[model samples]
Target chain A: MAKVPSELRYSKEHEWVKLEGATAVMGITDYAQAELGDVVYLNLPPKGTALVQSHKMGEIESVKAVSDLFAPVSGVVAEVNQAAIDSPELVNKDPFGGGWLVKATGIEPGELANLLTAAAYESFLEGLATSGH
Target chain B: MFLTPLNPLHRAAGARMVRFAGWEMPLQYTGILDEHRSVRRGAGIFDVSHMGRLEITGPQALDLLQSLCPTDVAALEDGQGQYTVLCHLTGGILDDCVVYRQGEGRFLLVCNASNRPKLISWIAGWQRRFPGACLIDRTEALGMLAVQGPAAPGLVAEALGTGLLALPRFHLGQGLFQGDPVLAARTGYTGEDGFEVMPAAAQAPALWRALTERGAAPCGLGARDTLRLEAALLLYGNDIDESRDPFSAGLGRLVNLDKGAFLGREPLARTKARGPAERLVGLRMVGREVARHAYPILESGHRVGAVTSGSYAPWLECNIALGYVEARLAEAGTVLQVDVRGRLAEAVVVPRPFYRRSAASGEAAPREPRAASAGA
Candidate 1:
């Protein structure tokens, strides 16, 4: 089973977001990393880039496939994780911690409502597991 | 889906299964990187039973095969195998194959599984002209395993109790495993010293078990693909197809047009004289991002070609690709650009075979330790 900590909010795109006041730190969930296999490369938006909620912000490349990473909430990119960029395996090792991809500040209030709670994301993942995706 | 004899074993080994060319095969066991490293450093075994094997035997077997395949089949003595291609009348490649001469009047053709039906029909259509020859599909009754890496020969000898390293490159030897006949050929796609063994279907499971128990890492198609790509070996469906000819794909050496009249010979000769408009070339991405299949190749902001195959070559520790570009721009070191999912990235033309063994020794030479990392 994938971990869905009660503290962080989740997106249908599989990103986990932890809001710190107006700043939101985000990374792909553990379930996302497990599905991706070995993460080889990551292309993240640069700092100060404006992102729209649910829009594609970047891409994550695995050995077998490449996937688009979506923005969970609209805001200006505040910081990009250089450690995750340099060594992509970190995302596979500690996706919930050091693997955090980016931080976004000046978040909109309505965007948080669009995100899923821990319980809701857990059920969503359960649906995906049973569906044989 | 069709299953190889080792399907049960793959599942037991915790393989991630996928549908490939109408067969249920393992995409990876443990991981592609780990399996790839095992083959490059130690040894790995691949269940390639899905490949099609056809047997041709008769007084006219060699003559019939020579007329269809582009390789110089008449030059092959008994026990020798040569990589060649089957072509259509328009000089389009039908499929690439390895033809093995078993004896004076017998031959074997190993082909891609997905093209088996087409190849059989194409060959059968010419049966009337060579009534002395007999073609038999041995795929259903036979199983193939590729034991690869530097340690492959020793591991295989210990498992089957027969020395195979003595077999020269492209040579086949007959041996017995548990008293059953098996054929070992010093051939592989991984660009490493290895042997491909063929045994009866019923005996495959046992043979696989013994090989793995003796330290042959069980690998899957995922690693097999990366290894072949790193070696610059062409995948039929991806790198060569009916839309392209062997000459344009950088395999002109295999097309023996001077030998005589053959299928696709006239067009191939004409194209050889005129030179190809597009030529296949190897590309090493300057960026970390991979340029996958069908991605546009650009030269000076203009679309010139498209990628046929691309990946993060685990062994090279770099993103590499194979693609056909305007022949004038196919020279090695030619800087190009590729649109990787709308992200334009720099790519440079490099010589084929992105990786090579340190020593230019024969196929059976002892293995050397690989670099600790790509940086080395």
Candidate 2:
């Protein structure tokens, strides 16, 4: 079973959003990193780019495969995680905390309705696990 | 789905399984990078039983093979093996293989898994000419394992016996495993000092377990690709295919054109005369973006060629690739660019074989420990 923290919100595409008032910190969920497997590169959007809710934000690549990263909420990119960008393996080792992808401000709180709670995401992941993917 | 004898073992070990060449096989256990480094720095074991193993025997066996292959099959003495290519009538490579002369008038041809069915039916058609020859498919009956790295020989000896290491490069020896005969060959795809042991299908799991128990990390096709790519060894479907001939693929040494009439002799001779238009070259990326298969190789803004195999070479600690560029731009140090997902990444032409072992298995020299040799 993958870790789905109770406090954080999750997206169906496997992104996690932790809203702090007007600012929101986001990263890939633990389930996302395990499925990605030993991330080697990231193609994150630069700061100042406006990210739309549940949209393609960037790409995460492993040695063998590539997957698109999705944004959980619509906001303007305030900060890019340089530490995670410098060391991609950190995403594999710590997907939630240090591996956070970006910080965004100018949050649209209405978008939070589409996000799932910890219990909902856990059940969603279980649904994926049993679908034989 | 086709599965190796060790399929259950791989599942038990929590390996990530993937489908390749019609067989379900492990893609990784721990991770690709971790297993790649394990094989380069220490020892790693690979279950390569999925590759086709054919047994050709009879009085006319050598003659039949000699007529089919561009390689000098008659040159191989008993117990020796040589890496060579099987060519089509157009001089395109049918598949790359290693032919081992097990004994008088007997040979074992190991080939890529994807091309096995094609080769079997194709070779059977030629068997009509050599009424004295026989071909037997031994892929299911036998299982092959490659134990590779600098520490491989020592560990193999410790687990099996010291006599196994006495065999020279490209030579075969029989090792005793629980009173049964296990065929061991001093040949490998990983460009390291190692042995490829062929055991009966029933005994494969035991052999793999014994090696892993003795400290050989179980690796998968993921790492196997990286290791072989680092050495610039051709992957049949990726690097050399029926659409491409051996000479253009940088396998001219395997083609003994003057030896005699063979399958692709005439076309190969003409190709030798005119020279290849596109030559395969090694590319080292200046950045981390990997140049994946079919990505266009760019000289300027125009497309010059395409990358065949590209990856972050775990051993070299840099991104490396093999691709066919225009012959004019194949020279070393020529700057080229690979369009990595629409981003042009800078790359330069370097020599083939981006990695080489200090004492590779190709050398005929005995590599027993200095301590053991000093006493003797």
Candidate 3:
């Protein structure tokens, strides 16, 4: 079963956000990691780069395919996770914790409201799995 | 999508299935990287039943094959196989094939699945002129498996209760397993020592089970592709087709121009006299970026060619690709740039067969391994 911790918010693109004060720590969800197979490389934006909600920030390449990473909320990137960048397999092993991709310092409150809560995201995934898509 | 004989087995093993050339084939069981590494370090078995098989029998089987195929089929002794190509009248490639001489008057041709129907009709049309020859589509009647890697010989021996290491490369042998007849050929697409097995379709599940239980990691098409690419193997549609001829694809040795008349032989001879405009070469990326198919190849800010197949080779641990470029720039050590997405990444031309075991050890080929040349 895919892990969906109740404290984190999610994006339809399969990104997860753990909000700490005005900063949003973002990473791909467990379900995303599973779908990606083994993560070999992560192309994350540098610190202080401006990001628009749902826009492509960088890329995540596995052995099979290349997927674009999207920003969940409009913000300025505060810091890119060096640990995950150094060892991409960590994203597949611990997507919710150390695998966090970026920490955005100035997330827009209105954009955060548009993100799905953990419960909503779980149901959304359930709908996707059941719909046979 | 058509199902293979081992469809149920793939499903039971939790393989991620996908449609490939009209067949519902397993794309991956665990992950492409894992399966790829397994085949490189140990052994992995792939259900390749989707590859088309044809049987030709007649007193003049060799004559018919020689007239159609570019390779010297007449030179093959019984139980030997030769890689060859079928071409159009215009000298464009139709399909690449491996023809095995099963007996004195019988031959088995293995071809790409997607080209089956067209090839059947193409050969059948010529068979009409040859009174004694007969053609049969054995694709649906037989199931295929490729057991590949350094550990393949031991695992195959354990599964079949006999050692096949004695069989020389490009040789075929008939044996029995689980009361069913099987044909084992010392040939594989992956640049590893292995066997390609063919048995009755109904007996596939039993063989698949036996191999998997004996530790032949059940691999899928995803790994099959990456493995072949690292070996510089040609993929039909991507690497060669109607637009490319054998000489241009670096398969000149396979074409027997000295042999008598054959389809496309004249055009091939002409093309040989005036060398191909572009030549296929291996490319190793200087950076981590992955170059995918159709990505532009640049030479000093000018577009030169496009990538045909590219991927992160697990064994090589680097991004490698195969592509065609102007013949003048096809030599090894030539620097090139590949446009990955929007950014141009540096790459270099290298010799084919990016990976090969030391010739002194294992069942490594005595000759330098042939570059996966041409699409046949």
TM-score of each: 0.94, 0.95, 0.95
- Predicted candidate 3: what Cα RMSD to the true structure? 4.0
Show how many residue pairs clash in every candidate, following the order shown.
Answer: 0, 0, 1
User: What DockQ would candidate 2 receive versus the native complex?
Assistant: 0.76
Candidate 2: residue B24 Cα off by (Å): 1.1
Number of the top candidate by TM-score? Answer: 2
Q: Which of the numbered candidates is closest to the native, going by highest DockQ?
A: 2
Residue A112 in candidate 1 has what lDDT? 88
Ranking by lDDT: 1, 2, 3
Task: Please state every model's RMSD to the true fold in angstroms.
Answer: 5.1, 3.3, 4.0
Candidate 2 predicts chain B with a TM-score of 0.96
The positional error of residue B80 in candidate 3, measured at the CA in angstroms, is: 0.4
Runs in model 1 deviating more than 4 A are B360-376
lDDT of 3 at A65: 85
Q: Estimate every model's Cα lDDT from 0 to 1.
A: 0.88, 0.88, 0.87
